[model samples]
Target: MWNGDGTVEIDGFRVYYSEVECVRRIFERHPETAVNVRPKNQLVKNAYMNNLLDLIDIACLAPQELTEEELRDAENTLLDLVGVDFELDWLKKKLDELCVKKTKMETRGDCMRELDRMIVEQRQVLLALEVELKNEENEAVSDSARLGFEDVV
Candidate 1:
């Protein structure tokens, strides 16, 4: 005969009986049997619960499951775990802004270097011109002195 819950066994007649009844009777007769049985069931339940919790955690962290609120909370928790402030778009935007500012700074630095080079070149040209002017003035003074000496002689 088959007992409820689909367990089958031979009925009374010194023959097989319902497996379910047999098990039930075994547990009843040996109450200590429950000590073993309960832990097994509890372990299985705990395993299932742990698996579900992991799935929920993954879904929440990755924005793959759960509601929007749950995702937000998970995101916040993840950011907190990594010691970062939670801002969905902040990282990307900050990187872009920094890149733009870096380019501008590089350009400005290049321009400043070019200006410095030009200033150095101008200083060299001015020094050359001053030397040439002094040479011309010396020649003029020497010519004037020679003329005066020739007149005196």
Candidate 2:
């Protein structure tokens, strides 16, 4: 029996709540249900799906703000859920990949900041050099004119 509110029931076993809440409640109430309800490796996938649904609810309720940690957790959950082969080794591999990707992204961001700083510094140096060159040219022209006047006299 479908409750039309993101919940369903079958033969008296009913999970009545939103997606995430229902799953969490069901897991809490019947730990064994985790094995029967979904593949062990896919647990993270189920959690991620629920979290995504919850995020939608959060967005509708409060669109103004969301914490970075919450967003990151959701992303991590999704990544963990993908390509699960129902094996412990596969699960560990997925986690490792996620960690590596996160580290690489952080490093790339740092490099970009350093590059920007270098560009700004270069621009300042170039401007200073241009000013110096202009001053030197002006001095040269003035000296040339003074020498010409002396020669004429």
Candidate 3:
């Protein structure tokens, strides 16, 4: 860091050092990036953090101040932002709609499962009907033969 600006030497060239560590801590709770690259990741991280601040409107809170659920919710939101590839505004909208997205996916999956069950039931019913028809035909033929044999006697 030089003159309060983050700078680093890369390939014999000096450049602005990106703070991907901050992003990892907020989203993954780690201190370093997995690959130690992606200079733009820091920008996304800063914007996401700022947006969270604006959304929550709380600057500082003691660890004991927030419940477990609240802490998890905040952490999940940041994690969600890290996965978003769009602009900051889009990220905000996505965060607000995250719960709905999951619900929709789950509901669709349930519908698909129900349809599959119905198909299996229909197939079983059709098979049973075919067997019943075959049994009735065999009984009719046997009744006719018995009648003929009785007439001959």
Candidate 4:
């Protein structure tokens, strides 16, 4: 028997069921879903995405003998579990917006690092100029002290 949750049990020979494998199985079952099939590293690293995939997968388990009421109930269960309105176009738009925001944040971080580097270099140049000015003042004072005057009172 298959639990429809990516786990099957029949003759005691079963495969390990994990969230990553569950997502892969969902893709295998519902080849028509238009969402991007993320890589294994992404599915394993993001808990929210994995659970969302699980919710999206619930529809693939439609029983072979579902009546109208059972089908409606199953649909409601999927909606309640995921909390998404399930509009394919709207979801795709949102995904694109998120990718744009991530890129902007990375660019801002790089700009901030460059600004910090410029500030440090300017401070070093100012320090060298101040040391040179101090040495010129000391030389002028020593030259004045060595000037000799006539031997008159």
Residue lDDT tens for model 3, 30-85? 32322332335555545554555443432244433445465457656656555553
Residues 22-67 of candidate 1: C-alpha lDDT, one tens digit per residue: 4455335444422422223433533432332333334423222244
TM-score, cand. 4 vs. native: 0.38
- In model 1, the worst 10-residue window by lDDT is 10-19
| Predicted model with the maximum lDDT | 2
Prediction RMSDs, each to the true structure: 22.5, 9.3, 12.6, 15.9
- lDDT of every predicted structure (CA atoms): 0.46, 0.52, 0.51, 0.49
Expressed as tens digits, the lDDT of each residue in 6-105 for candidate 4 is 6543222232355446545544554433244333343332443444554444333433333445445544544443343223443334434444554566
Question: Residue 4 of candidate 1: its Cα lDDT?
Answer: 60
Which residue pairs collide, candidate 2? none
Q: Please give, for residues 1-153, the per-residue lDDT of candidate 2 as tens digits.
A: 676756554323344454435556545654543243334333354454455345334433322244446546644554443333212233334444555555667788899999999999999999999999999999998887745566888
**Candidate 3: regions farther than 4 A off:** 1-87, 143-151
Clashing pairs in 1: 10-16
**Ranking of predictions according to lDDT:** 2, 3, 4, 1
lDDT of 2 at 140: 91
For model 1 the local lDDT of residue 112 reads 99
Q: Provide TM-scores for the models.
A: 0.37, 0.44, 0.40, 0.38
